[model samples]
Target: MSFFKSLFSKKQPTARPKLNHPSELQLNDIFTFGDSFALPEAMRKQQLQVVDINTLEFQHQHYAQIVGQGSGQQLVYVSFPNNPKKLIKLSLLLSRNEVEALFDLDAFSEIFEEPGNARLRPLTKQHIYADMIADEYIQEEFMISGYSHQQDYRGTQPPQYTEDQHGREFEYHCLEGGAGERSVDIFIFENGDTDVYLSFLRPANEITELWMKGE
Candidate 1:
């Protein structure tokens, strides 16, 4: 990874800014990884102390050692039960704080993510980082379902559908989840993404008519 040595320099480890999401945080804004601002709303209510800091000579990188105890909503996939915190490399900026870190979304995921739990579904990388998608429909659906009843059929996993008649097969690659109010069905086709319920939740023949008309 390229270093931004000119942007930030190391500062006192005791100094840090509280942040929720760093979307609006300017490039110059600085904070330590252990600060409560770097934590999720629920995780912040509990103790997330910075116990140690270590560095690697090979990569010329420093990482923070954190320990979090107590309990609250499990927003992250990883659990912190007397959880020996994950060590993540701090980015190098030209500021006066070499120890200071930016706990942005990617950094935040690394801390909460467990080893070897990645790559469950290669097609769903965004879901892995809890990242956002631009399609508003799928976004809203994910908000409702929260990965529950999730279905994946991309990469090596082919669509499970047995129906002989079908349009563009990419529509078959989907993530269907939940039911009732907490429900979402998204199809990531070659051309674009669309809600399954919107595009294909009708009689096969009726779907054919609409699909042909759209084509």
Candidate 2:
């Protein structure tokens, strides 16, 4: 073999590790990073441990899916923290930068570990949910896939406009509860009723179809 070929073959690859906790949680990986990086125990004690990591190509960015689980043999909840007395599997799509920021806050455990550890907050203009929805069309999709629902709950993506019977126009949006089984759908006008989520949980082509239909 050539000397340069031998030298290049010995170079190390820079990669992040795959992790699973409890020594029993099994996770599959598309690519493996043999040695895992565990943050200090003091930082992660009550938090969920990384179970698997995958790349998502859906967006025009470095998107990822990081799955984690409780320290014991417990499963996380996908349904609303309380109503469902059992386990559930949920998936979140986030950009790499967002994940890093959340990690810095040690938010994984607080936001995901278990129902008891979750921190709830109200929505305000400062939150990400305040972004304006498309003026072109309105869209909503819901998945009670691994969840149960209350008799009256709905959600909607924002900046959605509506016209009243008397030709008055008003805007509508959802203030909370888009995930799991609970959500609120609110409208500024009198004749509005809400019961679902306005979602971008679909493909670009699919969303384009919605736009065309709305037109």
Candidate 3:
């Protein structure tokens, strides 16, 4: 939490200047797209506050925290209630090879054929990382939507997908919300591996209020 606090605390002036070209605006530059803005400090803070392992709740039930570690990598996910129309997806990727191996598994095939079975696998590292990475379609959607590019493709970057130790990196994205809209907030953590969390339906503002009320 402290790490995130520091990461979001570094702020530039809020003033927006006219850009000569969209390319001049770096992905990290806080910019507006439709109803969404790049994850700003306030939004990031709200997300961190509500999504903490200590605060998460869904459907009047507390979430279970599950952790997985192996092959010099680690992954963590907190289980929450599911929405019928939209679901929050979490994935942990240890290596590029592991991701490739996913395509050949029977269980992976079943996930596509029966989507309702997607859930946090048991804490065993092999079981968790292999079964939980974002489904291929979601990965493709993220990439095509430009969110992946904004994060420098950190979620799919091969260097961070290796077994070698490296400093951790974090990336965030916020999609718009409201009536007939399915908003998603994505968080990616990269170390020797990558852990991705996608939040749908429950936007940061609602989550923050829910946490505050102990709901």
TM-score of each: 0.17, 0.21, 0.22
Please name the candidate that would achieve the greatest TM-score relative to the true structure: 3
Model 3 Cα lDDT, one tens digit per residue, 93-164: 235354344344443233323222322222232433322222232221221111111122211332232345
TM-score of 1: 0.17
Clashes counted in candidate 1 amount to 14
Q: What tens digits encode model 2's per-residue C-alpha lDDT throughout 1-215? A: 69889888877766433323222222432111122122112112234444553322211222233344554653221111223332222322334453343223353224323332233233223323222112122122221111111111212212222442112232333222334322222223334422222222211111011111111
Off by over 4 Å in 1: 1-42, 70-215
Q: Roughly what TM-score does model 3 have, to 2 decimal places?
A: 0.22
Candidates 1 and 2: which is better by TM-score? 2
Full-model lDDT for every candidate: 0.23, 0.27, 0.29
The predicted structure with the larger TM-score, 2 or 3, is 3
Query: lDDT tens digits, residues 94-206, model 1?
Result: 12121122113342233223331211112222331122111222222221211111221111232233565222333221222222111122333445543222111111111
Worst window of 10 by summed lDDT in candidate 2:
205-214
RMSD of each: 24.7, 21.4, 17.5
